[model samples]
Target: MDYYAPESLSEALDILGRGGVTPLSGGTDFYPALTPGGPRQSLLDITRIAALHGISRQAGGWRIGAATTWSEIARAELPPAFDGLRAAAREVGARQIQNVGTVGGNICNASPAADGVPPLLTLDAEVEIAAAGGTRRMALSGFVTGVRQVALKPGEMVVALHLPDPPETAVGAFRKLGSRAYLVISIAMVAMVLRRDGAGRVDHARIAVGACSPVAQRLGALETALIGARPEEVRVTMANLGALQPIDDVRGSAAYRLDAVREVIARMLREAGDG
Candidate 1:
């Protein structure tokens, strides 16, 4: 297999513009998808790009470079609003996967069960994509079109996951239910971010669920319901979960997923605090 590592985004984009090159970062997903003697792809490794390797504040929010690993994210001194993301980072895989898996890779892989998605959605994240022509940005909600599908066009690669600044008082929580405690895919997962005024009323709320839909989805109904309501008064009705399209598999039944989500949501609200 041919391999080329570029030291700059422009250089990488130039190579990608020529076409027929597979982008590689941590390869946590790429390598696993390959079989012995399977078809080989010409790889353009972007991990060497200096610009694509840090987490920093920009445009009043935060910029997490495409090559930044989960370990880096989990260790970064970010605000309380990012707690759900850090929690998701810690649960991405085992310690080794956490050490090597990149958020860019996770989003690009576009797994329905990707732990990174729900938290990012709660953060109102945007994806920055780079190409020889320049760059473009899109909401994380629209970037992952479906299971294993992303909106990236030919010659474009994800450059970073950009998070918009959230309410200073907003705090986040993440919960995933699996048959086992560690190293197991989630049967259902929920992430929530809430900001309450001094009067102890929820003014802003964002809730996202994964493993229960083709893509992790924000619970707009639930979010709207929480607004102006005290945390203890918050309720997740079946109508609130109507947006998720969970399918029955080995993890759990559809009814079970909905039931679990309600429990998870209640716990998450409590963790974020209640009136």
Candidate 2:
């Protein structure tokens, strides 16, 4: 019922440290998921905190503030390796949602179909968390524990995402399959970053899939298999996708998701490796 928008990180943390307060950002997900006539909860809006609002260069890579909007990410002049992430940013929702929905909210919500997670997984992103005690960092892969779940401890909040420097030659791509092209929940999605050597053999590969499992998963087997293969020779089999565990849902069947992921991976390989 009560809404508090703090101007500084310290102020926000102070409020968050007290139990029973829900941290709110853009509320793109919060407002929609609210139960009609449910008990009201106090809100601590973090959007006003200046520390959580930009994309800046860090020691070894880039730091994307938690409060950074999808629109900001889509428009930022980032590197080729970030192309997939930027593309995913544009696909987050409608223009209005993109203008307000933030990076932190998307991650904290921990939805399997979240467009941002796949690209971030491929980038080997790290989540930065803040608490009243101190700050800590963890791999994005480990941060999202399951569908609609995360590893945030009580009193802790995600502050930013850190991406390590990717190979200079790396290029990234994202592909999504849904019932509709826009404003639809994905049935299967793939994101990948690839780099070719002078001889045109894949030298680096990072692939991830979303919407087919509890948490978005990195295709470690596929990445390893692609290491010495040419872009045109890339092949993905069930063996290479051992990490996925797609389930049957109203949107699609588990078998359909696996098949769709294979097709999407093929497209992503060509786009990221050939482009």
Candidate 3:
């Protein structure tokens, strides 16, 4: 099979239009999932593309290039509003994996346990897509359709994630529960972004959970309920998780995952609301 390392996006897009290759970013997922010489699909190694790597300021918030590694994200000089994401970044894997795993790869892989999704969802991130045609954007929520699935069409790839400015009053927190303390797949995870009013009540809340559903989802009901709630009083019930459907897996049972996330929310609410 052919292998390519294009340094420019234009060259990569040209290669994509030819249609017989798979784009490989970071390879944390791609290399592991590769079949042993079966199919022999061409490989487009996009890690060298300069345009696809870095984080920059946008008009209102930030744009994180798709190839940006978890290490870079963890080290980025971001505000407190992004603390949850940075915390999640550090937990993507061990230090070595964090250095190699791309945020774009995590998103495109669409793993139900991906640690990056919930935090980014809390940030209200949108993905930028590049194709032979042009560039377009989609909400992070709409981009991941299911387990190991995404909205990419043939000849298209994720370019960057655009995060809108978080509320000035917002503070964020993240928590992950795994079979082991570190370097293990998630049993459950939570991310919270909360903005407090001057009266010490919740003005806004965005909560997301992973590993408890086919895709991580923001808790709209919980967010709505937290409005006007004092930080210590933010509460969650099973009703808040009606949208999620966790399965019984090696890490934990469906019931266990639900209970774990409920406790995660209860804990994160106090931490995140302190901002």
Q: What is the lDDT of every predicted structure here? A: 0.91, 0.91, 0.90
Across 1-275, the per-residue lDDT of candidate 2 in tens digits comes to 78899999988888889878999998999999889899899999999899999999978999999999999999998989899999999888799999999999999999999999999998999999999999999999999998899999888999999999999988888888888888989999988888899888999999999998999999899899898888768788999989999999999999999998998888766665555
TM-score of each: 0.97, 0.98, 0.97
Q: Summarize candidate 1's per-residue lDDT along 134-230 as a digit string, tens digits.
A: 8999999999999999999999999998998999988888898999877989999999889998888899898999999999999999999889888
Ten-residue stretch with the least lDDT total in model 2: 266-275
For model 2, the superposed segments whose C-alpha errors exceed 4 Å read none
Q: Is candidate 1 or candidate 3 better by lDDT?
A: 1
> Which tens-of-lDDT digit does each residue in 162-267 have in candidate 3?
9999999688889999988779899999998888888888887888999999999998998888898886786679998888899997889999999999987887
154 in model 1: Cα distance from truth in Å? Answer: 0.5
> Lowest-scoring 10 consecutive residues by lDDT in candidate 1?
266-275
